[model samples]
Target chain A: MPPPPLPIAPPDTDPPGIDQQTLLAALRARVARLEGAGREGHGAAPIPVCEGLGLSGGGLARAALHEILAAEPGCGAAFAAMLLGRAGGTVLWIGAGAEALTAWPPGLARFGLLPANLILLRAAQWSDALWAMEEALRCPAVAGVLLAPDWAGDPAAQALDLTASRRLQLAAEAGGGIGLLLRPDMAEPPPSVAASRWRIAAQNAAGAGQGIGDPCWRLELLRQRGGRPGGPWTVTWRAAAGQIDRESEALEAESA
Target chain B: MTAPRRYLALHLPAFATDRLRRAEPDLPQDVPLAIWASQGPRRLLSAVDLRAWAAGLRPGQALADAQAIAPDLLLRPADPEGDLRLLEGLALWARRYTPLAALDAPDGLLLDITGCDHLWGGEAALLAEAQERLWRAGFAVRGAVAGAAATAGALARAHGDGPVAPSGAEAEWVGPLSIAPALRLDPALLEQLGGLGLMTVADLLRLPRPGLARRFGVDLLDRLDALAGRRHAPLRPVLSPPDLGAARDLVEPIITRTAIDALLDRLLDQLCAKLRAAGRGARQVVLMAWRVDGAVQEVAIGTGTPLRAPAHLRHLFRDRLERLEPGLGFERMALEARVTEPMSGGLQSALAIGGRRDEAAAQLLAQLLDRLRQRVKVRRLAPRDGHWPERSVAALPLLAPMPEMPVGWVRPDAPVLLLRRPQPIEVVALLPDDPPALLRWRNRPHPVLRAEGPRRLEPEWWRGPGVARDYHQVALASGARLWLFRAGPPEAARWMLHGHLP
Candidate 1:
């Protein structure tokens, strides 16, 4: 476990970088700067995360992994659940395909997510999805919204501004709701004012871990808002109870 | 690509719902007919006038007096539900003109006939045909056409014939006409003009606008300038044009239900396949059956659900086909789904239901009931949406589906389905803190087999009285149960039948 492998930083990027502690400090400073600007032309309130939340290392790979796992909770149920958990808003799963709710990946409910909080919006096209998401966000009743591909697109700046200013995150925090963004694996994630991003991948067990099932890799956090990227960490998969355990023993052994 | 050559505009009255309700079999042509919601003339919910002649009928017109002067006038209850459904139907009808038609209101529609207008002659011919069809269906319609919206609206309101202002004649057509109401001027401006002796549209056109602006404001001047074709005003067309729909000519029209059903099945599949391929589903479906003679009989069904499944959707229209009259031999059939929703494939599981929720079946059943109610009369079907004994059920539209309650109503642990309008019930109860020993409803006394305690419901203190009640669910020995409630404060309760336990 030789500290896993660090991401290949852009050339002339201070070679191999500093230790995780120093990188974390720099990222934290940048997030604070952006968060301070707060969207309303007024200064934003400090991000109220407790001291215990994890941070990503200077590696993009680590950031991506942290973002996905933190956003999505139930790996087997639907990626939406994870996103909702991370974003703190409701999830609206919609599509003309099968039952939108039924199609959710497994293991969501096991993590204590309720379907009532997740709204399912129906749309006829990409444009409709955007309109639906914008409308759903205006509703203060919803904690936050997890817009499945059923709600995505590049809408007019006015429409986007309406959703952003609603402070959907604040509503979710106040009402205890979560919003998730579930999209196609190949989809170029639409430009949104999302707090973070993660690309999920399925990981296989090798060698002596043969008897265990393949654990899912949330990969690394591509981007995160207001929080330092947590260094790349492997989450061991558990099914009946969907919990991702960080391999602390492996990390320590590698560091020594 | 070539620019669209023609576009047709359809205007239904802002109050078309009220108009449809008061449509009469016989009324002298051009005579003003107004429909205002009433049940013996108290409040005028809305008024629809056939002729755009007088600017009278102020907001406070006494209903009885208004009807007294206009004897041959028609009046009925306002139906918001019916209006939405009818608007949807007309939207489907406009599809025959062009697939680019979009809803403009509960009343109006905008269609980009463009190259398609020639199919029904030219734009003027198309507009005429539209009015003719609506007139046959008992509608009083006024229409006009022009290259730009401002000029068209002005002409339409003024009863001037229009297609365009004719090259270099923009000022001539709009200048002479009086300003109409839709320009929505401030009442103060009109009042001030009335004082200044400027009464008619022609008067306003003659006035010096600079003086008017100094006295009133820039608003009136701007409106007058816009309508006079001096200033530019753009039309906000409600819908982006959609790709034209596809239709196949049948070899011959089949009269039999099975053949018709089979044809619909095929057409539905074809239409749905195209929708899926394009990732869309239709919200409105049009079924056209061409009789042996040139006339076409059409039955349209609006879907609360977006189109995706062809088979289930085909079943939706199966009931409708059985009801249509296939007069003479059939020659052709066409099916079109007008409003579409996004179509995509995903591997998600069914939504997790907290309890036994038969949403799909309930939806289907509601649809059937709505259709039956619509055919018989909209008043026949009522839907219950509350836990209160009364005011729980409401008259609903046939085409619209009932939305799911976010949470099954949080009813107090009391059993009974209250009537929409509570009926007073005679009751003989024990003293305070005691369950009812006997209750008489509909002129009969029932011995209480199992008496339940009072579920006290205080009146909304801030609102008013009339809502003060204490409810209870009582079971009679005769295997009959009743939801009983007492009106008044807790200290003085008067019993009534809040609802029945069905």
Candidate 2:
């Protein structure tokens, strides 16, 4: 049989000045750009948070899955709520079992997430919760999807494999929305395909003669796919300001 | 002026027996079947099948006598309710012949086929088609058409079958029918008339008017006049003519999901076209599939807002289509808009730049929510009117407009997670009303480093008297904040863990 023709241009047919390698590289780059544009129309802009937290792009990337783990008991939910509020569109909060019934509207409003912009979905099973999360993430009408699957009772069901997370990531990319997976800190976390991972711990904000102050958290950046991971920074959630403020700066301002 | 009114009446002679046969088609046809009813001391046959009728069995005959006559007679207790229900169902099914169909009680249906006859060619053709369809459906139907409902009904019941009586010929058509059975006269009156040799309706019509009035009551004259087309007989149709509905009868029964989906698409297109023309939208739509085995499977879907888009409506029905059980396939399907509301065209102010985008986004969100609702429960949270933590927020329907947050009611320091039910915790405090210094919850101990107030909240008076709860916000040794409450007096204090504050 005759040899199959080359899929691309033959060496002899290449332009005099431009080599095949350079041309191929340029073509590949263009194709990548086009594919990215097709998946995310107009490209999704990253959501900027406080500057000192050290996200390489100056913010959390959109159309990507981010894992938030609670080093303490309850800080992960708070952090996820703050991020959802910042995204500023319809947020689908999906949870399973008892975790589904824990979202308080008043508390959500404290983080600048209003009741009108939030849609709460409660699934009884972890699989259903994950499915709902993926579906919500794929809808362009939604701004973000927050899934907190409780598999504490079933040891076999606790791990969400890499394939499942990758599917969610792809769906998020197609929809141009953020995907936040909130979970409790595990002794040895299962393998994941998340773009970034963070650990949040509650910080005491009360001082002498001062009652309970605004919630403060110590946020630790544990992993970042293509950027430097640097955190363990203390920040106070100033509800009145509708943003997070550095703990030292906030305290100094309060005293001054 | 409108053309003279016409009605077609159908009579089912063996309705009770036929209903059972239709329900259980495996029943033996050669055997003599009878439906018996208890009358005081004796059980009498209320209805008998064709075979039983041929064997000289009759209604109102004693069951013992019937058994003696046919020894192998099949008997079933008469169900008057089931018989009437079947009759009503037949009346609804008869709507395929005309828009206005009404029940003629026990075992008959009346269709006001005034102008509808032309659709099936003519009155005779329409009657023949109706009878043919009914016969194919396992019914022995005798039908007649005349200028008046009373005349048609009387002729159908008396003559067993007849041709259409042209306009102004009701009297001639009913003249030859026996007066006693045809006009449905009282037994005593029938006996008296029989004694006087007045057997046929023509003979009674020939008698003097005054003497007939003096002898019989006004009801007798009323019946005669109605039959003669001198008085109008009104009918209450089973369905109003203006109801938005579309139905298709399949030549070959279909069982595959693809076929059903195609049929649904066509029906939805037809229904949505009607809705668009009427400048209205449906709020609730019902889809009914009639199985060949005489069973009907119905599924209904309701929309949060008026909708007429076929694609959107089809999407809403996609999930519910699986619920339809197509046993032995379906021969007929019907789609009806049970509830409707007037709808205007498109989004308002579509010409404007921002308004158009906003409207499109709102529509997209509504559609997304509708799709989510099919697989999961989607709800929007709203501030509720209550001081208790559990009652402070309410879950509203996804489409409901968000109500304004109640003023001065929400606490800025409310917990991020409020347990649906408070969990009891072991607490150690310097005083009963003070914040917990140490707490143990879920078999875990937490030492409180700093504490907040004992904000006392008294139970609402309308909720009946209850102990005031002293609530405290405390920071645990691990930096997690918890909402704790103590109830009852100092000596009998009970501590409960209520919420997790961020």
Off by over 4 Å in 1: A1-256, B1-95, B99-146, B149-267, B283-305, B322-339, B346-413, B416-423, B430-433, B449-452, B455-483, B490-492, B498-502
Summarize candidate 1's per-residue lDDT along B311-386 as a digit string, tens digits. 6567568667766777766656777665676645611112122221444533333333323222221121122444
Per-residue lDDT over B91-141 for candidate 2, one digit per residue giving the tens place of the 0 to 100 score: 767767676899988888899998888877989898998888788778888
Models 1 onward score TM values of: 0.38, 0.71
* Model 1 chain B poorest 10 in a row by lDDT: B346-355
Model 1 lDDT tens row, A117-140: 333344445444444444344333
Enumerate the candidates' DockQ scores in order.
Answer: 0.01, 0.38
iRMSD values, candidates in order: 20.4, 3.4
For candidate 1, what is the DockQ-based docking class? incorrect
Report the C-alpha displacement of residue A211, candidate 2, in angstroms: 4.7
Cα lDDT, model 2, residue B288: 76
